[model samples]
Target: MKNRTKIALLLLSSFGLMACDVATNTSPKTDPNTTAQTAVVSEASSSDNVTKEKVETTKAEVVMKAKTTSDGKLILGEQEWVYIPGLKESFKARVDTGATTSSVSAVDIQPFERDGEDWVKFKIEHDGINSDEIELPVERWVKIRQSSAEGTQRRAVVVAWLQMGDYKAQTEFTLADRTHLTFPILLGRSFVNGVAVVDVSQKYIQDKHKE
Candidate 1:
């Protein structure tokens, strides 16, 4: 009778142990494909997070373009631009820091040889305030350095009449088809030298920023 009782207790204990093990092992048995799918999903989630972060960082860096300045002068960069309130049109330009002269855009720079003197005839949009074309006469074609995206460059040039900020300055500019450039007029050292000092790190020094 004691042996029967001992056998019954042993059987019950063995069954309890089996039940505990089964309960502990209840994690759904997964195939290799399921495990791989889980890993892929996790990896894709991580990649998506990283991609979003990169896009946000790039957008933050692309704030409005800052204008160029140096000391008290406004230094124009190679392809900086400014709005002429008088002309009502934006002039894309390549700024030449090395040139002693500045230039404006003109079309049909034709050479008219007379009395062994060389003169270029061109059409100035002239403030572009009026659709009426103004014929501007050139004095001479002088060699000047033109600043470009590449570097400071030398080129043949001519002069034109331009008004900047209540100041009527005789600006010397090469006749350029600057329809493709950023600013239509190249503000060389001659145009900016004694007039205003350039402060390279600032743009639109006259404007206020909203926080």
Candidate 2:
């Protein structure tokens, strides 16, 4: 009887070991494809984050560059507020790259001789407002062909100090009647050359002149 009991105990032990082995073998195993897919998703997410950071950095740089120039010149827009020292007031000015010479609104323009030098007297008039009579030495005279008229009209040019933003310089301006024009002053390439760059799409890019 003792021998038979020992044999039955051994048989039970063997069966238990086999069952454990079967359970271990049948247990759910990790799918290699699923692990690979997870790794790929993680890498893609990391790559997307890096791309977003780069894009944001590029956009910020573009914005900063738009407000400034690489050559340390003012960035002018289609229109700007220019301060004329002679008039002691700021006026709206049109920035025209197509024009070769600047012009200012003037009326009662008369040319005379002063101390044996050519001089001109005029009053700035625009938009129903008129300035005091100002006399300046004539720098030169130019005849501009009118788009509406068949003949050319003569105008006197004078050197005037003008301030736009932080830039101040003396430039030549042709005296002409501009009461019907939108802006009293027209800035041309002569004024903008080496002083600023024109961005026709923008307006008032520079701060208004003060004092």
Candidate 3:
């Protein structure tokens, strides 16, 4: 009777241990499931933060792109004479908003080097016997599309100063053969845009010889 009582107590203790082991295994599974849910919430939060940052960056760029002048600009005529004091030469220019770049008549373009810099020599038409020639260091080169031709032409550009009446500007000019055109100089939008407003009905509104 004593041996049987001892065996019965041992069996009851083993059953209790088995129940504890089962509970421990089930508790570990629940912890991993909770961790997975937390990781998913964290990943979702990070994605939302990235989207908000992009929205703020785009808004800043939009604000930067929207720019305007505070003061008004000069109103100019369609036709004006631009005088260059350095050359003592004046050119009749057609203020054209259609063209993006300004053009000047130049013939016999010869590339030369001066002071280890690239220079260009071109002749300008005048009422004088000798072909009046000008030489300057090449500022840059531009590829332009011509209305009279099919393909584009690469022309040499230079920076020069010009006077119209009260307005004076240092602008870029591209050299080209403009003998076939009525005006020797075509003052494009690059020279007049934002600074002057052109009236097509007006002519010589500003004088170069007005001193």
Candidate 4:
């Protein structure tokens, strides 16, 4: 009878051990998406303002093929002309990735002083489509570059504040006749510096239909 009792106790202990093993061996149950989201949040928190300031780009070198302006105008890499919403028309323009100043075609360039400050008054046919009337603005002119244009063709231009797709930049444009050119707006290297990167292979990535 003692031997039977010992056998019975051993069996009970063995069963208890098996039960403990079963409890500890249970698999972890958690949502995969939740786990991934947590990891993403952690990574974002760890990184500095660099992650928060600009649009998140892929790990692989991201080339901005196309982008839209703050005014919702679509633009492409190295696109020559951009539609001005205010004018409701397209102008002849060029994208000069090397030029540091934005050049606009202007004619009848004149300068004057207003309110005891230097200002310029020039006329440009707003958008080559709708209005025939010229856009005349008298704004303060700051000479940032003396020899901005190509070689001996240096131009004196006025600086204006420009907004492109949540990016604001001051660009210098000259009043010159660019009517002969295919595009009226010349986006110089200066304008493209920080706001854009040129993909020489890609053109008109934004609006395919635009000329």
TM-score: the better of candidates 2 and 3: 2
| Worst-scoring 10-residue span by lDDT in model 1 | 202-211
Q: Which stretches of candidate 2 lie over 4 Å from their true place?
A: 1-68
Report the C-alpha lDDT of model 1 over 165-193, residue by residue, as the tens digit.
Answer: 33344566667655455455777787777
Residue 172 lDDT in model 4? 63
Compose the digit string of candidate 2's lDDT tens values, residues 1-211.
9999999999999999999999888968899999999999999999999999999999988865564588788898899988987788889999998999999999999999999999999999887668999999999889999899999998899999998766778999999988888999999999888878888888987777776
Q: Which regions of candidate 1 are displaced past 4 Å?
A: 1-95, 114-117, 124-134, 143-156, 206-211
The lDDT-based order of candidates, best leading, equals 2, 3, 4, 1
**lDDT: which is higher, 1 or 3?**
3
Tens-digit lDDT string for candidate 4 (29-141): 89999999999998888675576445456432254533654554444456634555444555545577676556766666566666676555555643354333343344434
Poorest lDDT segment (10 consecutive residues) of candidate 4: 126-135
Reference-based lDDT, residue 10, model 3:
100
Alpha-carbon error at 1 in model 4, in Å?
96
Say which candidate scores most in lDDT.
Answer: 2
TM-score for each candidate, following the candidate numbering: 0.42, 0.69, 0.59, 0.47
For model 1, what is the alpha-carbon lDDT of residue 171? 63
CA lDDT for candidate 2: 0.90
